[model samples]
Target chain A: MTDTIAIGTADRKDAKTGTVAANRALAGPRVNGKAVVMTLYLVFLMLPIYWLVNMSLKTNTEITSGLTLWPRQITFDNYIRIFTDQSWYSGYINSLTYVVINTVLSISFALPAAYAFSRYRFLGDKHLFFWLLTNRMAPPAVFALPFFNLYSAIGLFDTPWAVALAHCLFNIPLAVWILEGFMSGVPREIDETAAIDGYSFPRFFVKIFMPLIASGIGVAAFFCFMFSWVELLLARTLTTVNAKPIAATMTRTISASGMDWGMLAAAGVLTIVPGALVIWFVRNYIAKGFALGRV
Target chain B: MTKTLNNKAWFLVLPVFAIVAFSAVLPLMTVVNYSVQDTFGNNQFFWNGIGWFQELLDPSKELGGRFFEALWRTLLFSAIILAIEIPLGILVALSMPREGWTVALCLVLMALPLLIPWNVVGTIWQVFARGDIGLLGWVVNHLGIDYNYTGDALDAWATIIVMDVWHWTSLVALLCYAGLKSIPDAYYQAARIDGASRWAVFRTIQLPKMRRVLLIAVLLRFMDSFMIYTEPFVLTGGGPGNATTFLSIDLVKLALGQFDLGKAAALSLVYNLIILAICWVFYTVMTNVDADRERVEA
Candidate 1:
């Protein structure tokens, strides 16, 4: 338990102010064992991702008949198909549009709820907080069938907005939960300080408290976008071929004609890039936000 | 705007409620309505009361598993995941470089596996596990492991568990690493003055500090493992038999495969109830742990 807490809290302050000597001192042979272990773990982690990228750059014949560490001849046909074709790029746009919308909407709604729960005592506040999390606990399958039926009946089915709406079921809970972490990190004194200055509660929240948790919100948004960008079950049900996400689009490669392994791999490689880019830009936030969200 | 009571918080909560009502609550109400009633073609319906629920509860029904079998399996799965991940994640976090460019590289690369869609994960493993062409299958065969996940139940279950571990362990590791990084140097200094052993220091100092975060990790992991569907769905299709079939898979088979909305809805409600109950326990335990930590600190 203490280990878990240490890891979670140590995350935010770990911008490494240590001297190179101290850092290198820990990297001696004993530590190298751990690093080697970590390296093996990394290799275990990257092999499949590399395979996806490898296959993506190859032709169907190459993918089916032979196996190689790297593609003999790199090709952009798969990527070209994704950009030029309707089904391919449509998934990207639909996913990105909703992902952005969901991220923004989730924060907008969850910020206040998280703040209320974090800073104040009110009627049914605890229950409401728990209620928010109930959405997160339920299985996606439990909701998928009903969501499909309900969305179809209400004429909201088969739209990107519908996917965005369905996504909120999970994303809102996550946003609220993570934002609550950030809000909790800010001492209640900050709110009272702003209050003492005659700043309105609303004004204080937007001006004072928001900045304190800006990093937290960024962390939460990164997670929301990451999860939404990668989700497939809800993405699959909410859209057909027209609005299907790239992940779902790859499923078509399994048709009876034969497996389009090369094209599918290419798509898979493309799919991973957005996530990698986002993580690259926000690695610190991710390292911090992950602790709040999970640990 | 005043301290007395700013009711404007309702405005923020209202959208969440509305969105949930239309999306989650309304659909749930529809499920509740369906659960108690039967439906015919053209959406004709009849009141079936608790008949479906009772039948589900009955042991004779093949679908009606013995009470603890499914429940125990679920619990066992959650336990296995928590036990493996919490320890392994901690170890990984502890091993991570305290700070540097390498940390960023490691974090980004570590997160890559998690960013892939669950189905894509399943697909990747599916192709990668093929005996004829898949590297994993070919290597295992060469080593004479007789590894056939598609045909054997235990193998399938083990494979699924391993795959899940691969997909999710990073979450626990990353979280733990963050928590580990947060300890003030003062604590370590005090421990050093006391001539504390590494194990003692870790147990007495670091572990206690991480309780709140660990609680969160456990709950999130429990809920996630309990609700998992897509990866296993795509990976094994809940086969070679029913070995890897979890409640989520069963629910889908009932609802979508058979289109038995009444029964499936009842099952789903029960499903939600079980999840809610587990999460409730998890949250209570977490909050309790937090309270205990506060008392100790105070």
Candidate 2:
């Protein structure tokens, strides 16, 4: 996939304006058609999220009273309850702690490996890369029991580090793959140039190469954080108390009594905020990241 | 760019190897150990050998029957998801604004669903599709159709599929959009010079250009859908009589719910094998296509 994108980019090595003018020409005749299609699609995308947000702002009685497109009587009790409660708020903190750790660990581990894979031909490199991907493909259900027993035995069962470490099985491979794609795009001459100038390997990597692929690092970090933040099963399995993610806390809302619809909606909204903020900050990075290219 | 022969790159890769091994290898070894053994609690065990594997493979047996049923359902779900999502995503991508602040606005909105945790996705759908209060359920029932997702198997299946599409189609669209953006406009200009029809331009230019990212989208969606658990488990609880129970949900039920470690471990191995086999097929097909493209270009 990266290869194909690279081919496309290589074809565009000519001046940028030539392509931009051609694109404008191509898109000109279909403006009306494009607008309608985009409008309809965005509405579909926004509707369910709107419904969830609507539910969160209303009282439980209003929610059960009838179906309405918008909240008739707004209330802040649900959001207030989540904010004031220890268990509810702490779930978010615990989740953030592990997700941050996992993203850092995964990206840091992947950097040098990606550099190696991109720049050098090591023995078993292909096999090792394929092996890493297989871990990503492995279902967490398969590892639930073993992970439980293993973490417990190691006395790291309920800590944030446990979930962070477990997530590396999948996230590290992904990080490595993305970073490798970006690194391969950098001309090998740059590394040779740095070395010829008497720069040490680590020094050269940190100072010269890192900034060159900073966008790639941003993309890789975004993905690592996204996957770790959203994953529920492994995170839930690895932690019971100290590191219980907000997703697990949402499940507790379904007690023997009944579901707490309003509270769950509120908590769900809060969980989405951090990701939305991250996406906003890295919105452009995400498009290039989705390219899976070294843009 | 010829890479130097640098076996010493192993040192650069060692940290990744250590961390991944500690997480992946140790737990996998545990799974392998349990698959071959049996126990009746209290740290006692018996060597079961191939007993569980034999039982799991025999369709006449209970565990075997459930496993195969769940496996078929999972494959069907992935097929349906891919069939609907890929073309729909491309259509949406084609319509997306190519410039201005609207592009940023569209990108963030399209990405909104992807960032929400999977369980919350299920919860939103479960409530959204409920006949009692869900807008989807209320609207459907008001339209005079017998639609009860909780009580009806078909509704349960439809709701789950729709929920999945709603949650994930954005991923495909975003990848396709990125691919589209990468295509040099010179291709389109050349097509226009040749008096190519819109369809002709799409078939010869856009589709081929999007192939690589499309492959990534397909593979990601397939693997994720095939192993789908948390969403369905939360929404349907694998019910309406196991209508929505995919392989992961079944494996979790066996491993955690019933505490049948031996059978569950065997099932897990079989499950992993199936995913690996499918992924290998995808990888080979993609490599062949890439090679073919290169050959033509040469």
Candidate 3:
């Protein structure tokens, strides 16, 4: 759609113009049915997340005792265990390692490819672009076995890099798509002017073009990090001992005795923290990216 | 909008191609190799060309029946989720406060579910929907619903669907909100000047503007619902006896659980082809719409 392309142009125009009247028109206080609907929806969204946090603070005995809206006795043991224990905390480090690698790899590789897609036509360009997207549509479950066999044969098995590389199959295409939207918005005249001013391609891209699309890169990176961070199946299958993710480790609580309800809830809460932090940082960019129809 | 014909751009795309090929192409080729063959351990494969594919396609056969059942279940799930979530998301987005701290708060809270690791989302709901300890299960039972998700098939389906709506409805809402925000106030003013009713304004201006983002929302929700695995896997483990077994879960059962590599490989190719075909249709429609817009603008 034209809706997608039109929004892209409209985004750049709005950013440059800073339409104050439009902002003022959309802003106001509402004390109507709409507010009630929004409030009820927020409650629905918050309750489950709140329940997870509530359970994390209770002892296993207390959790099994009965249904309580809030914990009667708040405890820090679950948090303390995660901090003190090597296995618990190492899971976070392992997850972070691959996620960071995947995000960096996806964005860096995607940058040049996105630039190509936005600016030029090469052999099989359209087909190649579509093929890239098709890879994103592949279910990770289907590829789990083959990825295991393929990575192990290459001797990259059980490593963070393997998960990172595997995640790139999806992330790269998405990064290219989002970044290309932003890149296309930058006037080609900027590139020509930079060239005429004696700047080389790399320098121009780094100093001029990159900054122009900094928010776009931020949005792309946010997506890559989120997808890689939350992914469980591929990460779990690819890495065994040294590079196990926290999501996988959380499942270990399902042992012979029973599930560790308290600790599992605690681990679940901890997994949310990094993502919350990232969203906090990228909050502005997400809205802008959405406006551009790039995400 | 014409692109410069520069073959040198291939150099720029080489890194992405190389990495994706290593991960996607080689593994995919392995799947293709396994699809047409017959294997019985010892790493020895037979030249049983098209045998597994035949078994998978013949509905009278066990494999074929299971595949169709799972496919149908997956399609039905996607349809139900889309029908509920899209309209609900639009309604929520319309109601969202447009200014002040409420905007930031809403954005963050709405994003919380999306950020939680998928399995943890299942875990949270698994705990939240428990008959013994969960608030929901306790309340529902007291209300005389006799709702036991672990025992009953309908309850299990309802739980998974509700859980998915809880998890992903925010995505549709956020995208629609973004689309709504992109519409200029001038449109509203013009509608107002014409004495347009609230419903008329929404129908004429808002719905039209939201179309592209809704398309994105539909495509995403469809593909994700089709390949849904983790949340349902954690919640039900694909049962109260295959009741909630969608395509991705079934494929995992065949590939990983049974280790029937040949049949699993054949199933995977079929599963992937369906996704490919549907996504291709979405892509072509989207591009054609884009092309039409460009023509009008020119």
Docking class of 3: acceptable
Model 2, residue A42: what's the lDDT?
89
Q: After superposition, how far is residue A127 of candidate 1 from its true place, in Å?
A: 1.0
List ranges where model 1 is wrong by over 4 Å.
A1-29, A196-198, A293-295, B1-12, B66-73, B296-298
**B1-298 in candidate 3: lDDT tens per residue?**
7789999999999999999998888999999998888878889989878899999999999999999999999999999999999999999999888688889888888887888889999998998999888878888999999999989999999999999999999889888898888889778667544445457778999998887788888888888888999999999998999999998899989988988988999999999999999999999987787787669869
- Candidate 1 lDDT, B99-196, residue by residue in tens: 67889989998888888777888887877776765677778878989888899877777777777778888988887777777789779766644445
Between candidates 1 and 2, the one scoring higher on lDDT is: 2
Error of 3 at B227 (Å): 0.5
Report lDDT (CA) for all predictions: 0.77, 0.88, 0.88
Ranking, DockQ, top scorer first:
2, 3, 1
Return whichever of 1 and 3 wins on TM-score.
Answer: 3
Tens-place lDDT per residue, model 2, B159-219, is 9998998899999999989888888877766675554555777788889888888998999
A169-270: candidate 2 lDDT, tens digit per residue = 899999998999899889999999999999999999999999999999999999999999999999999998888999899887779267788988898899
Q: Name every residue pair that clashes in candidate 3.
A: none
lDDT of 3 by residue, A1-295 (tens): 4433443454454446685343223332223667999989999988888888999999999999888888999998989998999998999999999999999999999999999999999999989998998888889999999999999999999999999999998999989988998898888999999999999999999999999999899989999999899889899999999999999999988882776888999999999999999988877666656544342
For each candidate, the DockQ is 0.38, 0.45, 0.42
